[model samples]
Target: MEYSFRIQLVAIVSLMLVFPNTQGWGEDGHTIVCSIAQARLSNTAAEKVKELLPPGNDLASMCSWADHVKFYLPWSSALHYIDTPDNLCTYQYERDCKDQNGEKGRCVAGAINNYTTQLLNHGTDNSYNLTQALMFLAHFMGDIHQPLHVGFTSDRGGNSINVHWYTRKQNLHHCWDANIIETAEERFYDSNIDEFIDAIQQNITKTWSSQVEGWETCNSNETTCPDIYASEDIKAACQWAYKGVSDGSVLEDDYFLSRLPIVNLRLAQGGVRLAATLNRIFG
Candidate 1:
């Protein structure tokens, strides 16, 4: 389908809301881990890891990894750190330069870089905890793929943009973080767990290389992916102003549908690359 980014986002948001009570695994962190685990299982080496895990509940293993990895790589908590209206003016002028006198510039870049480093350096040695490490790596990689997570200092990744999600009121950041995917699952997938996982796996295998390269290239820069955040902000702002308005909700549905492929693609890339990284390390 020739879907735009906005349409995909709306679908995702809708999917996210449909399964509100599924578990933390439905969250970005868990979803990323699940995607990576599913990707790994698609390969030969992951077969052994698969054997080691319990049967018929790979999703549980992924969620366990998501929880466990939180320890060694505590930096994932930084993902939750948001910029708010109260704090926007405080850090608005901070430049991309290293000398910028505030936490905003450094925090966003540092979080991404740190997460990447943790993924690369992860192993059973150094208290790396293999399953958890792989899961965490998978989750964090997916986190960075979302542009809002690498967002501007002023708005704290769009957290400041107040809006209503259907009947429930929330901000843009939270909406993107959960609402988009939730909504999509409801409208499109209708809570078919196996189908959801299968679809994500297929998408991952198809677009693995490009997605990995995109993140790897961004990580190479000492600065965070400024272009990623900048481009997303423009799209996000347009989404809010034109489509995501309180009464006029054009962007949510259109954006969700458009961005769904990208999200699926990113999950696919994260899963395959994560398995590749593990195979390289453990094999």
Candidate 2:
């Protein structure tokens, strides 16, 4: 029994070391986006999601599958983010949408487009793994909305920038990915993820209602427009995420309070747009 316990503990530690900090939004953020989307899904999309998801699993439950599986599917690592030119704060698909080896169409935006195309072939195509496609689309929609995911190349989307979240040591990327959202929950939502999600959902239908339609709009009959999403993300990355703060800086109440709204808005947009894309594909 003692030997078995040690082996199990070692395995757990090894896994943690391998995936120290998740690239996209932490589990809570992805869950928030997906839960909001599931509620807004059209009947057709809902039914299709039901069919594709494993028994007893819903869309929100599986929204973070891509983040976990990326370790096994090493090819998927680059699909989670796009590293723009350092300090440029601009994104152009042709120039910025490639993997480290210079392979085009390998960035998060391109992954969205590819998966959108694959999911569009549902019911008629057996060549693509539509289950994987659906999950990828759902997840990438959330990823594209995370400003730091479309952040500066040098910092690897803030992952390399050492910062303090209040008094705790943290990387800038992780701060945007999880700390900010977690802090908001503790401070305002009773530390309940569901409440945080509900707050964003309420804003979606009320505060951001006017902008929801535009956020869901795809130009020129396209199924999904990731380029536009990417453009918006980089701008936000510069304006909100990368604005004011530097290496070893401590981000406290002031930073958290101001950026919380941007975080909320992005989560809202991610959910609204995920529902829209699923509707278009499965409608």
TM-scores of all candidate predictions against the true structure: 0.56, 0.92
Residues 204-242, candidate 2, lDDT per residue (tens digit)? 889988999999999997888999999999999999988
Q: Pick the candidate with the highest TM-score.
A: 2
Best by lDDT: 2
In candidate 2, how many Å is residue 16 off?
Answer: 11
On residues 1-283, what C-alpha lDDT tens digit does candidate 1 reach at each position?
A: 2134335434543454443432222364355545555555436446645643334435433443433333434644554222323222222214431223334534333443444455445443353333333444445444544445544456555666677766677766666666766776778778655566676766544645456555434444332343343344334334332243433233456666766665565445445544554454445
Count of backbone collisions within predicted model 2: 0
Model 2 residue 67 CA deviation (Å) reads 0.8
Worst 10 residues of 1 by lDDT: 84-93
Name the lDDT value of residue 19 in candidate 1: 37
Q: Give one clash count per candidate, in the order shown.
A: 45, 0
Evaluate residue 242 in candidate 1 and report its C-alpha lDDT on the 0 to 100 scale.
24
Q: Which residue pairs of candidate 2 clash?
A: none
